[model samples]
Target: MILGRSAISMAIGIWSIVEQAVAQHASNNRAKGAPITKNVSMTRAVYTKLLREKVFPAIRKKWPGRKTTTIMVQQDNAGPHVQDDNADILEAGQEGGWDIQMVSQPPRSPDMNVLDLGFFLFVAVATIQDTFDTDGLIAAVKSSFAKVSYHTLEKCF
Candidate 1:
């Protein structure tokens, strides 16, 4: 999902890369006609694509005030994550005169990466629901994200 916010705002929106497809093998454990959820591996190419197509647009759209606002996107030091100055990302960030840069969290500093702490909480809340299918699961996640209190988000940031 494309997650980041000003001190006053919530997440931009929920955007999972999951896709639905027919299950290759039916298991006795699964309910009849249950949907299958496939998670995509996050590669650098995939990550860069998301930044160009999803994150940059969302940030530009949701950011409050001023046309020339500069934004710093803070992410963890994951292998799939792109460098701060990736050419394609830099091009996307420079679009329409905006300056957006990706900054990685320092190594060996899990406490500094609070984004994951809150993000995982959202997942925990989502999984608590008795969702039966992809649509139901998506609804559950959206509901959970919607319920995130400003006070809670304030603490996370």
Candidate 2:
């Protein structure tokens, strides 16, 4: 889900994903550069489902008999968000007998995480180009996101 706020002079979009990508650039002195766009990879329910379906399956497929492998869960330092959703994933991993580790992100450090900056800039560029039509926006977003590999993202920022 996307939560947005647009008033006289500011626009902000926040996604359900615990991780956030933020980008800021200037078009003019007085005008806000651009509305910050947010991307959420997986929500709690979705993330849980992915753990049950995709992650577990991939792990089992790789090492069928062996029950242990190092698994890492990386997340930003948001207490409420982590408590609400991420904790469940951690608990489920333990119950499933998977050796899992949790990596808490440093607070207020979007730059430390590449995905945040990269993904946000990609979305912003796509949205700006796509302001005309809904379908066009989707296509643009998809194209931009697809191109957001390490090299492309670096060039964008």
Candidate 2 overall lDDT versus native: 0.49
lDDT of 2 by residue, 34-133 (tens): 4344544555565566555555455545545545655554556644334423566667656557654445667787554655665677779778772653
lDDT (0-100) at residue 125 of candidate 1? 75
Per-residue alpha-carbon lDDT of candidate 1 for residues 1-157, written as tens digits (9 for 90 to 100): 4345642344666677777766666688465456778777889988898888888888878874644666777777889998887888888988988888777778768666576677668878787889876667777887887887656766786
Clashes of 2: 0
Clashing residue pairs in candidate 2, if any?
A: none
**lDDT accuracy of residue 68 in candidate 1:** 68
| Alpha-carbon local distance difference test for all models | 0.73, 0.49
How accurate locally is residue 96 in candidate 1, as Cα lDDT from 0 to 100? 88
TM-score of each: 0.78, 0.45
Error of 2 at 89 (Å): 1.5
Worst 10-residue lDDT window, candidate 2: 1-10
